[model samples]
Target chain A: MIEVKDLVRQFKSGDRTIKPVNGVSFELGKGQLASIVGKSGSGKSTLLSLLGALDKPTSGDVVVDGVSLAGLPDGKLTEYRRRDIGFVFQQFNLIPNLSAVDNVMLPMEFADVRKSARAQRAKELLEQVQLDPEKHSRRTNRLSGGEQQRVAIARALANEPKLILADEPTGNLDEQTGEHIIELLSSLSRDHDTTILVVTHDRGLARKADRRFRLHQGQLNEDVTAGR
Target chain B: MSVLARSVGNAFRNKIRTAAVVAVLAVAIGLALSMLVANQAVGAKVQELNASVGTTLTVNPAGGQGFEGGGEPLTAAEAATAAAVPNITSVVGTKALRLRTETTTTDTADAAAGAAQPDAGGPGGQAASVTTSLTAAVDAGTLGNRNNTGSGTGTGTTNGTEPARTFTLPITATGTAAEVDSSGKALDITSGTGLGDYSAASTKALVGTTLAEKNNLKVGSTFTIAGKTYTVAGIFDAGTTFGNNAVYLTLAEAQALAETPGELSSMVVTVNSMENVDSTKTALQAALGASKADVTQGQRNLETAVSSLNSVKGISLVAYIAALATAGLIILLIMVMLVRERRREIGVLKAIGARNRTIGLQFVLEALVLVALGSVVGAAIASFASGGIASALVSSNSSTAAGATGQRGPGGGPGGPFGGATQLLTSVTASASPGVIAAGIAAVFAVAIIGALVPALLTARIRPIEVLRGE
Candidate 1:
């Protein structure tokens, strides 16, 4: 579960203040999948960052699983992100020199997982994401865009977080590949009872989520008709 | 993966670059270790010189120097008085004599050159008339013959009144009160033993190694001096050709042979410490009544030599430090470049919940690995190079000091205290002992850690949000 209360993030541009995320509030239930659709500069990614604890808010708080993100120290914030939240970026930022399995095992290593259990867990995650068994040993840079994104998804799930925040995860893939990624995310939410939030520009992808919201002028509004 | 494992993997990501860096580092470290070994060797040599030759004083007859001055030979009474001076540890008396074959006679030119004829007084105010049945081992070379023959009939003679004669080299024979030479260095006896009592007249003599070899003599062999038979008690190696072409006899026997009983050519007096040398010299002079004996310290040549060696030691130390600093700088620059190139990797590690300490530790571990490889090769290079480098340094510096002081050249004077001092200057032995090499490598590692840690700590300032956003 996730909660956002009147979150406002401001930045100074030369002389004037710009609020990328202004007076936003929302909630998502457990096992639910949601999407936020907005144009460029509409703060869709900014809101997701606040919920993931990657950036601090100028005003208000974000609570995940009843733990407040406001004014938390750096150490505790890092632990929260590592233990409770996972992130999938638009560029699929996997280390290029590492094999797919090695990239997936990185987060578990940081979490101090047993060295003997990490490789097995990483392999199972890769299987769950439908990556080819042979590709697991290939460097991420040599993999196709779709394969790399799958490895990134597998990495996000390595620590078994309660929530996953994906900011334009399919932004760099073809339309057909993006559809498959969306279906995979939906299935992950339904099967694991994990909360999933996606920020995207594709209305078709947005319509398949359990709940749909549109961000405009730093404001968030739900679209009931578009939600399945 | 563990931070150490990851660091090891990352260090060789570019194998060519790592090899290049390690090669350069090994050379710098090798040079540093060599200089350190040289410095340590010179320091030890200086200590040896100060202990052995620096503390001794020579007392020769007043107005009796080389072959020109004529004065009364030093007597046993004067030696006894010198031994009573405060801080005097021991006193050794010597009687000098030159022996020629019975058939050889000194010509007029030889007589004028102080190669005086029979019963004529020679160096150290001793008689040169002692004849021996043993033939000379060394030839009178071109210089000796030229000096003796002149441009006359080439058959050496001042006039027809003197018979034409072939010049022959004389053998130097010294009478010592102890087993040591005039410079106080113990004889390196290679065979047999020394005379049992130096004060009692005996037929036993210590023959020089070269002289014994040329004459086909060994320990227990018999030889005749002035028709008096004596047995070789030992064969001694004096570490030089000229030094090994002589013989040593007990002071009493030499005095009996020269017919100068109770007389000594010089007395070598040992003081307890070098610091007490000047004061001891003054006291000995006062005790001997200055007019009766010439008390000489002969430390100017020794000081010039020791000063040059000290300069070499200082230079080697400075060079060692400079080389070490060069190694440190190489590590620092290489680590800085690695940190800059790996900024993205650092940001990613931070994003993945890795602590700043972990990332910094990785780079440091990587640096230590490089240094370890370099040190192995550097130690080998130092072991092979240190000796030659030290010898070269001593040779150059000692030669410069020798030139500056204009000390006596080879064969210019008798082998005495001054000769030993000159030899001490160029005899430093540089060895690369394991302990010194190990200490050197340890210092290099310490400096390398500091050099690498600087750039490693810079990783703490990288922000994941900035790196990712920039990407």
Candidate 2:
């Protein structure tokens, strides 16, 4: 579950203050999938960052699973990310020199998982994302774009976090693969009871989420799609 | 998936960059390690030599270094001041003068044979006479188990006229046993004994090898100097003709003979170590005044040799520092580039909940790996190459120059104290052991960590959101 009220993120830009997320508020239930759509510079990513406990906002009260994210210390925020949330980026951002499986196992390593268990879990996660065992051993740089995105998704699942934040996860993939990734995320939200939020420019993907919110000029407008 | 595994994997991400940095570090650390070994080796050799011979300051009348100065000779009081100076363990003072000998063949048969010879005044009963001059001193001869008598030499002469041709012999009348020991000029006695157990006050004498052999004089044979008879008690090998013709007696006899009851021509002050030589000389000068005494340290030639060799030591030390710094710079530069290249990956890790230390640790580990490899390769190369390089750096010309200096003496006067024995160093070989290698590795590891840490700390400040935004 997530709750945000009056969140504001302002940055200094050459004597001018730019508020990317200003007085935005939202809430989403557990096991729900949601989408935040916005034009470039509309602060969708900034709000997501605040909700993910990745950055401090100028003013905010964000609660995920009853834990306040705003103003939390760095250590506790990192703990929240490590134990409760997973992130997927538009670029996939897999560690380039590492094999797909190694990339997938990275988060688990941060969690202190043993080497053998990390390897096993990474392989299973890769398989769950339809990546071949052969592909799991390939360096992320050598993988196909879709395969790299799949690896990123598998890595996101490595720690089995309660929430997944997909930042344009399918942005660089072919349309068909992007659709598949969206379905995969939706399936995880429904079956595993994991909440999911995707920030994307893809309207087709956004429409498929359980809830949709459009961000404009640092303000949020909700479009309820749950129970559709 | 482990931090070290990930770091190692990242180390080779840019093969060219990795190899370039590694190559630079290997050479830099290699040069550094080699210099370290060379400095240590040369320093050790010099220390040993210095410890063995120690140091001796020659405090002479201020004006002349040799026997040519015009200043008044040091008085007994002045010499005492020299002895009392800090670092001066013992002082031996001397008063030298030319001793001209008058000889006559007492053997009537040899005289008849000499008279029958054309070179003998054609049997005109021209009692053939020869005159030889020597510099006799009241300074004690070095004659003890303590190289307090480090290395010195003396000279005398023997005429072929068996009946007795007057040959001038340089004689030293020693005042005390310790003074004699501090002379370091004491010859190794080949026959008989040491001036009678190092201390009996007698008008007895010791003859050099050449003098003993030439006149057929044995331990009990008597010789006359200043018209006083002295029984020979020993024959000593002085290693050179100049040294082998010398003689020793009690200081009272030589002063009575020289007629200078309380004057010192020169003073030798023994010091404990070479490090103390300069200070001892300074103190003696301060005590006696600059115009009163010209202080000369023992083994001037060897000191010169070591001085020349010390330049290489200096350069190598500088090189070691520069190399270490350059290695650090190289790591810092490479890590900066690496951090730039891996900015995205760092963000991803951070977003996945990696702590600042975790990310920094990976870079530190990577830098350490490169440094570790460099140390092994550098040390291995230095172990084989340093000996030759060090030898090459130590100019053989300096050693020869030192030899020439040692070989030089008043070919006709006493060889003085330390003959050619001051040839202390020729070549030095670095004897690096496993412990040395281990120390080198430890140093390199530290250098690597410091080099990586600066950039790694920057990584800690990276914001994941900004990195993702930039992408």
**Candidate 2 segments exceeding 4 Å error:** A12-17, A225-228, B57-83, B90-269, B272-297, B396-426, B431-433
| Pairs of residues at least 3 apart in sequence or in different chains that clash in candidate 1 | none
lDDT of 1 at A212: 94
* Cα-lDDT of candidate 1: 0.83
Interface RMSD of each: 1.7, 1.2
Worst 10 residues of 1 chain B by lDDT: B148-157
lDDT of each model, Cα atoms only?
A: 0.83, 0.71
Best candidate, TM-score-wise? Answer: 1
> What ranges in model 1 sit over 4 Å off?
A1-8, A22-32, A44-53, A56-73, A211-228, B1-5, B12-57, B65-180, B186-236, B241-313, B368-444
- Two-chain complex of model 2, DockQ on C-alpha atoms against the true structure: 0.59
Candidate 2 root-mean-square deviation in Å: 9.9
Residues B1-471 of candidate 1: C-alpha lDDT, one tens digit per residue: 677777777778789998998899999999999999999998988787787677888888888853347677888999889989999999999887777655433555544433324455555456445666656677777665666453211125556575455567667788999998877778999999998898889999999998999888999999888789999999999988778888899999999988889988888898997668889999999998767788988664666677788899999999999999999999999999999998877776776667777788889999988888898888889999999888888888876766667665667531345564356666788889999999999999999999999989998887766666643
